[model samples]
Target chain A: MVEQGGGASGAGCMGCPLRQRSEWCVLNEEETRFLSRHLKKRRYRAGETIFSAGEPSHGVYCVASGTAAIRKGNAEGNTVLLRLAYPGDTLGYRGLLLGENRRYGAEALGPSKVCFVDRAVVKLLLERNPALGQQFLRRIARDMDEAHDHLVRNATLSNRDKFIHLLRALMNRHGRTATDGGHFMELPLSRRDLASMIGARHETLSRIIGRLEEDGIARFSGRTVYVARSHWLLNDSRPPTLLD
Target chain B: MVEQGGGASGAGCMGCPLRQRSEWCVLNEEETRFLSRHLKKRRYRAGETIFSAGEPSHGVYCVASGTAAIRKGNAEGNTVLLRLAYPGDTLGYRGLLLGENRRYGAEALGPSKVCFVDRAVVKLLLERNPALGQQFLRRIARDMDEAHDHLVRNATLSNRDKFIHLLRALMNRHGRTATDGGHFMELPLSRRDLASMIGARHETLSRIIGRLEEDGIARFSGRTVYVARSHWLLNDSRPPTLLD
Candidate 1:
């Protein structure tokens, strides 16, 4: 991995684990060489708002390292977390397609490095190089698929299923270790944040977590939570049409 | 409106109100002349599936002169209706961008005349005729706005809210009659179809409709549903997350 450069115009970061691992960050040597010239690396501390929902958007963000959550705020001051973006995930393109300032706020979970590529650079790379664009497009589609799944959960899944799904999603996105007798995922969200992330009231969230812990499906300490068994949670309850 | 002079296409139903006033099909004499070469029209009877969810999506579609319903199906042979599309509305581009089959299905509610444009021709037009492409892109963004709002409802709103939103959306899209008593809009869906459209079971749909009529928001006669009190149903339930 090249470590001598640390700015937007640097033609390095090639063969770095971060670069090689992410499906969204699958740039080859030449492609990495091309992008590093256009990508400026920026850092954000925990709880820092990277971008607001209505700010003018220019570049697409790729998480080089660290964690961030995308959320939307309502008039009642209620906040809903959209997703926790991790290394290799691209932030803000879905909003960019809608126009002008985005309609969601993104905030860093902890110390995080993000690479910003100007939208023009992204368009050029997508149009000029079909293969690279294909990779990016595939990633976008996957993001969209996840978003649609979220839609279904919000519509159909029970609260318990929502909680389980939320954990499963985070584990899928950023689980760093399959520890002995259990798994450990390095996620960056507090209980309140998790409630917002899954669209549950804080009290409701607490009950669900307590229920899970009592049943040994989960355990939590600090910001980390563990599941002793996951698959069994499927039968706790299924999603319901509450209005009915 | 010029009677097409030399070339001829999409002229089977000339007196249709939707065709006459379609925002997307407002081609003047010369513009119609320019577009005639690229237009192809197809007709389908009532209850016909125009396209399925997983078929190769070739190009964008517009209702030249008919009503169509956008729907989706799950593994249980259950269908979910997304929206009822009419003249001036474009479908399939979202799938086209994803380079996959459409996420929803479209079926004819009546004998319908639909228009088609070649994807290659659309690409050429976007490339060689930038203004047209920009106009089309704006239209695409607007369509996506509707989709996004629907997604927000799917995410945040309850099932009753979802039904109210769906009714209001129909009025906005295909509204026709408004008397002093209550506004009248053509009901384009069967009760089962309405259930699918709002992701509810049929009995649940019956109960909601029964209640909506009881609440004086809407009344249904045959296939036509008259919705007069739309302000609250349309504006009140919108989640603040969307405003963000």
Candidate 2:
């Protein structure tokens, strides 16, 4: 279930932390004011559904805080965690732009807040501001690049290596560097979600975690993962391409 | 190796069949004229590299004919076929938009032709044509949606089911309706490429193909696959979502 938060005012948008992001930063003062007038804030608790698969997309959601899991469910009743949406990330725009029903469901992994802009409002804004449309294009292109990377890693990486890569990716996104030269972060996803994200079985992930613990590579306590030697996670990781 | 073909003249864009597609069709006459003036055509022999991973993307390629495989190579030297590009599909735009080196390489699956639009030219066109930018956004969004679908299938479908889905998808894209009520399509990919596309070993894929032949569902002839009962391929496939 979701709780409707107070509507964001034009002033709110002007001061929004997300405004610093390239996608939002490009919006002019007038455009920001127009968007804020239609923006609705929704708060979801942990495990609450933000949207469901097959639902008609009415608008786009931009995560205001916390993380959400984008999941796809199959006929076998299994769910695959396609990716995670963090603060400043937008969702549902793909369906809106393509005029298709939602192909996947999104759920809040923890207490989170998101801002919604109706489809019609987005269209109107894009028509008035071409810069906004181009920014969206760039954002989607970046997403496509990441999706390709994920597809390749899924097909080629060993289960252990995938886990390490996932950890490193998450760390890069949210980890706090420690004086001990390690990194610490609270995992937003549950164990099952993590397994789904890496396309591994729950039991298999548990076994891998146990091995990591034995090797002092990482420690899991509650919802937190502490990397003892972050560099170790890079071992066996795909080498950077020459261009990189 | 790449071979330069005749440069497309402005008049060519006016009559190009691809212009009928939504992405290109959105281009106004003036925009088409501008694009044609800058578009260069290139031809590739079967198995020739169009672009390699880590290369700087100078521009985008729009397939004119035949197919190309988008592939990713790992440190272990194993390659994963991410997807196939058919006629009217655009490539390399992701890296161009993100200002990153190409994350994956693309190879011609057969003798093929592609039209190239330089980065500077595209940017100028987009700056002059807001509709063109919006159309590109829609195109990228559709691609992202498909990538999500592929990821979900990879995570949830069994190997046999995945193969069936892949066959059905290809058939939908390129198959010819047959008098026998079955669809016949030449497989653009080699057996090795097919195995990589489905994230399976060549031996495993061969075994599965043998089983399909024994079951009388699909027949393999050289590089072609004939579905004796097309509907049978839908068995065990993911049910269409309520929205679909």
Model 1, position A242: C-alpha lDDT score: 25
Fnat, one value per model: 0.10, 0.75
Candidate 2: lDDT of A195? 89
Candidate 1 lDDT by residue in tens digits, A1-244: 1222335444345644567655436455666677666667787888887788878889788787888888776544566777778887778775554457887778889988877777887767665565554465456656655655455455455577778877877776666444454667665688787776666678888898777776667677766766543443344333232222
Where is model 2 more than 4 Å wrong at Cα? A1-11, A177-179, A230-233, A237-244, B1-11, B177-179, B230-233, B237-244
Give DockQ per model, in order. 0.24, 0.64
Per-candidate clash tally: 6, 0
Give the per-residue lDDT digits (tens) of candidate 2, residues A1-244: 2333324443567777877873767888888877776778888889999999999999999898888989998767899998899888889888898787998889898889888888998889888877787688888888887887788778777777888888888888879988898899988777888888888888999998887777667888987888865454455533331233
Clashing pairs in 2: none
Please state what fraction of the native interface contacts candidate 1 reproduces.
0.10
